[model samples]
Target: MSATHALRSRLRALALTAGLIAAGAAAAQTGSGYFRYGDARLSLAHAIAVIEEPSDQADERRTLVFLSAQPLDAAAVAAAFDAMDAVREQAPAGGYVRLCIAADGSECGLFYSPEGFNSGGYGDLALQRNEAARIAGRWQLAEGDFLGTPYDFDLRFDTPIAPAPGSALPAGGGAPGAAYNAWLEALAKGDVAALRRMGGEDARGRFPEDDAGTVKESLKSLRDGEPLQARIARGRQHGDQAVLWVEGVDRDDIRRRGRVLMRRTAAGWQHAESDLSSVDE
Candidate 1:
């Protein structure tokens, strides 16, 4: 062969080899699963894992989410957990499967959609391969009827774990203890005015002007039949944002723990998000 022709043939071979390598790399990063709820069927195309830190109320957990329509990057996965409502509202025509795994490798939660299937009667979940960077598993649930609808689920995934998001900002600044304490006190006293003042925009919106009495009753019922005596145990703050971990016991002898996300404003720290759950001894 001529030197020029030989060179051209070599270049074509190299290009084909490069394309095959790229396709293989893409395949390695992807995973597959599917489920059917009632008559709706969906296929999952991507898998990602997110690590959740231990809260004052709950243990550390890892969540594996399978996406149906679109692939997600690490930041997008983090954002999905942070703002799930927004993600759901903007989600495309496909559904998702979420599996929460505890630190000890047990399945803690399973959820899927197309109407929801949160009722947990999981039959089998086998994690044949579990590693730091990769997980392969199969999940199965027998056919059953729920709330008048018939459904069944089965899923399998084999994918690399997307890198965990960076650690949270270091705990600093004065814990927003005062605001949290005041909010709790107001809740106990049924003081609508104080509660409104300490609540952030999202929290304040929950209190409707036309339903003051209902709001008071709702707040009163939040404490159950006993009063809560919670206090902030620790906190982390960065700029205008902060999170406080609270620990305490109720009058009924049940331990209550929670975490509150706070945002600073002209009126001092206000509650933006709060989650409190009881832990039984």
Candidate 2:
């Protein structure tokens, strides 16, 4: 064979291979539910977004999470780590696609990508169906400068909405609420031992002899010289985890509100953490 002819044949073979690779990629992108970030993409298989009824007419936000077991790239793992570090919350193992939507379905506040977390106002969101039993939504960001990279994001999800776990109950009534009330009592009485017990194995040696005093001082600084006096106003328990909302009056008689997270161990419900803020009267 002539040298020129052989070289031309080799080029044709390489072109054929490139075309085949492109075709395969195009096939991967065709699906019912998918998340695409830059050059990588994932097929979302499941979704969960529960909308809880607001208590006391407060603003409520709902989270819609779409998960895909299909592997994307190494960047997905890095993105999960970034989310955990940025929010101090645990991220799911597989491809994690999340959106924080307002209760009225007016807007989406957050969007997750392989690059990292993106705050509100970067994309166009559309909700095709938003209901208690199911939800369908799409988020698209135009191809442009995003997070110092020339990339874009697109996610389309359609999946059933699972019911939010647990039942809501009045203060100090249900089991979880009662447990929260007990925790408040222990904290007010400066009972470190009881606090440790309520904290479960994770809190076995966490509290020191001066821990109660330290906590009180911290509360005093936030509560205007008053020790924390709170009562669980509502609660819900789902399996081993529970959330209890508390309402209280501070030293200045100002209203305060917070939530307590609890985990049920063999010994019973154990305190996980609490977050409190002053409520406008």
Candidate 3:
């Protein structure tokens, strides 16, 4: 064959290969490696985003990648991330937020960050993601993690949390909210009788005479120093139970500590589980 002819044939082959490669790239970006678990789908980029960790190399910085269950454009993902960024802006600085869309319309995921060294602090990511999945309604996603791994949480909408009405008794106070406020006030004042009274029958049973010594010791220790000066930041109610989300300045000068008191049908607005316990002190 002529040398010129041979050169022309090589050029043609190169062009064809280049076209194929371009098409493959587009396909991969669209939906090449998205993982599907029933109606829920996680994209390859998103999976990588969630599992990615900090690297020794300085240039190994992490970036947010928003993936949809179905095909989405860069613009669509960017818009979602923008909304998440807004939420992040509203959140206190030095924290992480996880963004993921759950099967339900409600948002699901983690939104917390430790003080330093990738600490796993408030709003435990794993637990939040699991709980978000359980609730009904669609869940929107959010970003929530530093180094973003060790917990691959997805974003979900904030479920309206309210306190159960008539649940808390008026012990030297008014309504449930008022009583809770009074309880905290009494607790701050070291008013044991008032605190005990607010405890109602259930709290009393839990703090009976047999266990009074230990209970008193514990309660006294907690009530000793200005009662932590807590304020109700928010409240959420679910049937007979409710959660009084509080922010308190601890004696240790931790500034504001996120605390939660779970109130159930225990004769009054009695203390239940505490979310603060989930964090590292």
Candidate 4:
């Protein structure tokens, strides 16, 4: 073949390869990737935006690709996140938020970053991701080590998270919210009776066994192990229900956050489980 003809053939091949690459890039931006699970039709990118925006300040840094089982229900999931966000903003303080929605439309994995980390701290990226996944209802996934230290986690969810039906509790200095703050203070002082009295009956409904033994044990672990140092990021209220963010430290001493759902009963506001409800401290 003539030299000129050979050069032309090579140019054509290069063009074809470039086009293939561009197509792949576009697919990735649309949430195509390995380990994609959940609602097959949901737009992972959109859901990710809903969870990551407040924390990242609206600039999306990466893509989330999940093979979904539900149709692209980005609208509903995003709405849920928005409702939750509105309630969180009502809190006395604010913090960073991250979330992930499953494709089936029944679950979401999430977490928050509390105040104080902006100054300086270790970047516990793996724990942050794992915790968020667990919060979003990915309990079935096996626990395994993340980063170097021993750990266990999975982001696979087959069930739905409790609806984050926006806050419904009364604002400051009322029964439950104020009472909850008192519980925190009392807990710090190891005043178990004060904690019990402050906790409402309905609060027991959602908590494990709704008894002092369970809660006291959990609180004790926090007091001794991680030493909960959290900023009251925010609180939300809607009717008798509420949510709280106690931005605490992660395993690596980084400022990660946890949340609790408040359930109000006849006596006063009670505490329930939230994504961060399982946190040790």
Tell me, by TM-score, which candidate is best. Answer: 1
| lDDT of candidate model 2 versus the reference | 0.58
In model 1, the Cα lDDT at residue 29 comes to 50
Give the candidate number with the greatest lDDT.
1
1-281: candidate 1 lDDT, tens digit per residue? 99999999999999999999997775465557567777887777766665544454345546564555566554455433253443356564676767766666778777775566675546587886677676778777778677777767677777666653333543332547666667777777777777788878855655666887768666756556322555665676656777666776765677766666778899898867666677667
Instruction: Give a tens-digit lDDT track for model 3, residues 27-120.
Output: 3332122222223334322111221112212232223323333322333222221334433444433333333433332223323332222223
Candidate 2 Cα misplacement greater than 4 A, ranges = 1-46, 52-58, 67-94, 144-147, 168-171, 209-227, 249-258, 275-281
Q: For candidate 3, what is the lDDT? A: 0.40
Q: Cα RMSDs of all predictions?
A: 5.5, 12.8, 19.0, 16.8
Q: How does model 3 score by TM-score?
A: 0.35
TM-score of each: 0.69, 0.63, 0.35, 0.36
lDDT of residue 256 for candidate 1: 69
lDDT of 2 by residue, 1-281 (tens): 99999999999999999999997654332113555566666556544444433332346535444444443232222222122232223344544666666777766564554546565777788888777566777877766465665545666766555455456665574776666667666766657678777866655445655576665654344336222565666677666777766678766677766566677888788777655566777
For each candidate in the order shown, give its overall lDDT on alpha carbons.
0.65, 0.58, 0.40, 0.40
lDDT, residue 139, model 1? 77
For each of the candidates, give the backbone clash count: 0, 0, 38, 29
Evaluated at residue 85, the lDDT of candidate 1 is: 46
In model 1, which range of ten residues has the least summed lDDT?
164-173
